[model samples]
Target: MFRSRTKDGQAVTKVTEAEPQQIRDPQAPKGRPTPKRSDALAQRRTLAKPPANRKEAAKRAREARRADMQRQRQALAGGDERYLPARDQGPVRRYARDFVDAKWSVAEFFLPIAVLILILSIVPSPQFKNIAFVMWIGVIATIVIDSFAMSFRLKKGLAERFPDENRRGAVFYAFMRTLQMRRMRLPKPQVARGERP
Candidate 1:
């Protein structure tokens, strides 16, 4: 082994000539050892109990799903925005809904009129039948024209308001909402008729 003289004049062995000492790794796992395979299997087996009957298991599962849906609907209705469905959660969609809900449209009356027309068409009176026929044509024509106009305005508004947003289905969504009677709109109207968005 080579020796080197230190500044104090005493000879010291070079670090390269000394044997290295073992050092423990700081990241090494410590504490309780892993369980045996049999022990692990036993633990897993005990964690969950199997249902005794298929019908009971199914009923329990159905109840769980029902509860989940109810919670989701409540969250949406309460405007807990985080829990809203993918299509309805974003600011652009919310704005579109508000825009449509704020205005009055012929399409908004479509559902009730369509139902009335169906009832009128089935009546025994020829007068009712003729009225229903004329009404149906008028309703269809009015809805078609109004839907076009609503969709055009809605698309333009969404573009102006949310230029960075992906508005792929926003127009269709607004159009569908317009087709429903105002009072029956889901996630019910936040703004009253004639209110500005």
Candidate 2:
């Protein structure tokens, strides 16, 4: 069904119905209304206020920087001179030297020595007291001797290979290489646990 309309001798049929007007309730709650300008102004005022205590923030930042610098200095000086002799060798050679010099390889070789030391240190048995002391001395001596020999060997090797290269750069590179462990992270074939093939 449609309503017919006439204008300037032309007739048109309209099928759509007009939407009903919205009815306002006089007794409706005021909470449903849009926010006023005062609310918006208050929000802007809060946002525009300066942050509290700039001095404390600056002091904290300076302290953090100072602590960081101190740590860096300590790390730089702690082992630099001690490791200088082996600073330019290849990764494998350097690691091998380090392992031997530190007498860590001895521990690897003599598992029983470590176990004995552990047992002696922890157990209160009187019979094994002397044995523990002997093992401790032997381990300590081995580590010291190995470290000195390895350092000497490393220095000799570096001198032979890099006769003209700047020793400082070589040393720095070697130290960084060893400390950062860049070589160990390289992708390579590895023996997986329980793998037979």
Candidate 3:
């Protein structure tokens, strides 16, 4: 502010605070559009500053992917449905998993049995190979029968529990779960073997 001397030897001045400018970021939206809950959470959780260059942007992307993978891994081990894949989501899927995990299945042992048979067949003797072949066939038959039986039971249980719910792919989902050893099951078993789901 400046005061100027007038012809009358008096100083007159008008003083007022300067108004601040409302600076808006060109890249920022005027209003945020609605986003999915998960998308919103992810957006809110990102770094405050934007990447300055292509290299930085790529690095950020890699970090985000790694974090996502870590969360998924934790979810699989802890059975957090929020972080689980689409294939394992929903009440019907959860019930199927619980049902399958609550009981033992011959299919779960297929991996170990197959390895044993493979080693047996590696021997030079023809008889050894024949025995291995027979064992393999038996294991295959047992796994198939066990899977079918489990699917039937799962279908019935699903019908009773989730009659009007989407049960599509549930039997297959349960069947895949049955193939994994109880110790290795993704979304680690919520129910212990022989424990009623």
Candidate 4:
């Protein structure tokens, strides 16, 4: 008792559903049920190993020995040789490490100078004005030197830290560090933790 409209806009009998289409390609493989997880795991395990030769075993042993020696050397070096430290340590130390690893930018180098200039200009004292002028010149000079020095430092740091020279990640890290001024906050440890220490 379904109703439908005809192409000519007159009333017509409604079709309930369309017939399923049959596959015409005889070469096509029939669908099968997916293998169970355990079955798949068993298959993988079966294909996993062929047999380790003496040379392969010796190579693995050598690699293990090299890794052990490297670890021993790192421990003797006071654990500072590693660029990234392990997690689960105190927050303060982690923050310090992260700050040191961070890169800086040109704008970051100028930020202190700009702030110093503003502070000096705002203060109303003749003697202070003379001091401010000299200080401002010093600040400008420092900014210039820091800019060049930071660039080289960042490049070297990235090369040392990453096996691959990931310039893009390094640049991004540097920009974020500059904007955050993580290193500057370190000297005043109290401020770093949002309190006076």
Candidate 5:
């Protein structure tokens, strides 16, 4: 123990002690109220509990999946850029799709014409089969020429519009999209046929 002298020159023993509990000032800003421990424990227990049964759990999972798909479909239909798939996202892709969709392409009719040719060739008549073969050749040539022209135009336009965008695979994407009928195209065409991009 150590002795200390005060102003009066009296000896006194000094004792060190911990600080007393602090009194909160009523005028001071009070932050958010502290949550109860019981409330926190209840929330944790509720989260830890499993569903009533396996069937119920499965049903909930299925419903969640359906909801997610529904949201995706809505986003796709609306062309909400954020939720679009990688292949269809970005302003450049949208521009390319619009450019392809706005014009008519000979390839759009290729499927039906090919089917027609097949039916004609199956008639078992040599003359008819020869005619069908010739028609098929013409169809192929026409589509090839038209597709080449369309692809050229699309590439040129994309280059002009989005000089900084990566052109790789974009041409093929536009070409494939151009092959489908305008009405049947997915992410449904934003512009009508003949509409400018």
Candidate 6:
């Protein structure tokens, strides 16, 4: 405080300014403490390094991918959709799988019949080769017709059951599933033949 002159010519005292207080924020800090540099570096094993380190990193990646693939394969065989690849991951895809699995497809017999035809075509006799060629063409035509029928039915069923759901690629997905052998199908058949999907 200091003495000052007023308008009345009197000595007066004034108060000094007080220090400003820091304001506290309402936000809370992170629950964990900051990590040390060494610990952070140790966690990043795939960071760029020497040529040998790069090769080792790639090997590690392969091993991880192999393990993941095996796990997915087991999941597929067990009909567990949780670990399935993206293409097989949704209600629509599942419905398509069930629909295809419940029905026998001419496309499924395609592989075995094709192999038989291949063998027949390799025979020395011209008659067998001609027969095999005709068989192959017939089998392919049958598969094409069957695929179209299945696609139409699947599209109709999807439209009826899932009017609002995304149906894009669903017909193709079901058709491809129909082509695969039942035992070899991924996200294996949950429904038996004669069961309605």
TM-score of each: 0.64, 0.33, 0.72, 0.32, 0.67, 0.66
* RMSD (CA, Å), each prediction: 13.2, 22.2, 14.7, 21.0, 13.8, 13.4
Task: For candidate 1, write residues 95-141 as lDDT tens digits.
Answer: 88998999888988887888899999899999999999999999889
Pairs with backbone N, CA or C atoms under 3 Å apart (clashes), candidate 4: 103-174
Model 4 global lDDT (CA atoms, 0 to 1)? 0.53
Worst 10 residues of 6 by lDDT: 42-51
Candidate 5: residue pairs that collide? none
Clash pairs of candidate 1?
Answer: none
Q: Which runs of model 6 end up more than 4 angstroms from their true locations? A: 1-67
lDDT of 1 at 185: 75
Best by TM-score: 3
Checking candidate 3 for backbone clashes, the offending pairs are none
CA lDDT, every model vs. true structure: 0.83, 0.50, 0.88, 0.53, 0.83, 0.87
Candidate 6 Cα lDDT to native: 0.87
TM-score of 5: 0.67
Model 1 lDDT at residue 5: 93
Q: Which residue segments of model 3 deviate by more than 4 Å?
A: 1-47
| lDDT of candidate 4 over 1-197, digit per residue (tens) | 46788789999866556744466797676555579999899768745863378887677678768877676555434333342233212333333334333433345556676687778778898777788788778766765676557657555655565545324444444434454454453222223333221
Task: State how far residue 111 of model 1 sits from its true place (Å).
Answer: 2.4
lDDT of 3 by residue, 1-197 (tens): 56888999999875547844578898988554669999878777666678889999999999889999998999899888888888888999899999999998998898999899999999999999999999999999988988888888889888998889989999998898888998988989998889877
Residue-pair clashes per prediction, in order, are 0, 1, 0, 1, 0, 0
- Give the clashing residue pairs of candidate 2, or none: 101-147
TM-score of 2: 0.33
**Predicted candidate 5 versus true structure: per-residue lDDT over 22-71, tens digit per residue:** 79998887744667999889767756987899997898688778877786
Q: What is the lDDT of residue 49 in candidate 1?
A: 69
Among all candidates shown, the one with the greatest lDDT: 3
Candidates 4 and 6 compared by lDDT, better number: 6
**lDDT (Cα) of model 5:** 0.83
Q: Please give, for residues 90-174, the per-residue lDDT of candidate 2 as tens digits.
A: 4443433343333223433345677778888777886688788887888878856754554566566667765665444433333
